[model samples]
Target: MIGDPKTGTLQHARIEGVGHEGLSCSAVDGRPLEFALLDPTTGEIVEHGPHVAQEAFNVARQVYRNVMKGQGWLRVLSEPAPLTARKAA
Candidate 1:
């Protein structure tokens, strides 16, 4: 369980699932993930492993973190923001 599965935010990644064939889970992310969600609208990260296998959670953690940082989170948090749209008529 990642992101807000119940809220369907997990779909944004198009991840569908992670891990091996027997142990896969949905990947989750959203603007709230970048600090926009309050307790009511946000879900905490859920770990599905004790990492019986080496480099399991560690690798996943790195990957997930990178995704968030590389995505709009970096721009969204910057001062004045950087996502305003240029409208055309």
Candidate 2:
């Protein structure tokens, strides 16, 4: 999930879903985006910022295994499951 952190209104990383089987995620520079969507025509963001961007990290990590195996397109889980709860003892 590591990519260019600064992408204007919505800062995020781009995953190519290529290369080696090994993949890792890390927070590069800058901070999490406060807003998820923006209006190009009006140049004004939505009143209530959607937290989808922030939730992406949690979702990705929760399905890291499927991603690494290139099974990201598959429906591995019906809903996002916290990695902490699935952590190995």
Candidate 3:
């Protein structure tokens, strides 16, 4: 599950490998899983696989990570802070 932090909108997803079909409401599990992009708010399916493919899922996951980094939500805590003149004194 992933969400738009700014909008509070959520997306539900399921990924299961081949032969796991119908286990978790998955219709087909060929490439990886029965992949479905669903809008939780409207209970609608935005997209589904065998058409959506694993690459699409990888892109989506990377996009979410990029968004978090852009919003300063994934900052690295180990980095040193900038030194000011007052601190130098």
Once fitted onto the true fold, the runs of candidate 3 whose alpha carbons sit more than 4 angstroms away are 1-33, 60-89
lDDT of 2 by residue, 1-89 (tens): 48866533423543222233323232345433343445878877643233444344545555776767887654444454578876853
> Residue by residue across 1-89, what tens digits does model 1's lDDT show?
55664634544533223444222233244321221212444565433242322234444555667677776332212122244542321
In model 1, the clashing pairs are none
lDDT of 1: 0.37
Error of 3 at 8 (Å): 26
lDDT for every model?
0.37, 0.46, 0.49
Candidate 3 lDDT, 1-89, residue by residue in tens: 45543532324434333432322222233223455669999979987765455545444455657677786443322222368854886
Q: Each model's TM-score?
A: 0.22, 0.28, 0.28
Candidate 3: the clashing residue pairs are 16-32, 16-33
Listed per model in order, the count of residue pairs whose N, CA or C atoms clash below 3 Å is 0, 0, 2
Positional deviation of residue 66's Cα in model 3 after best superposition, in angstroms = 9.9
What value of lDDT does candidate 2 attain over all alpha carbons? Answer: 0.46
How far is 29's C-alpha from truth in model 1 (Å)?
A: 33
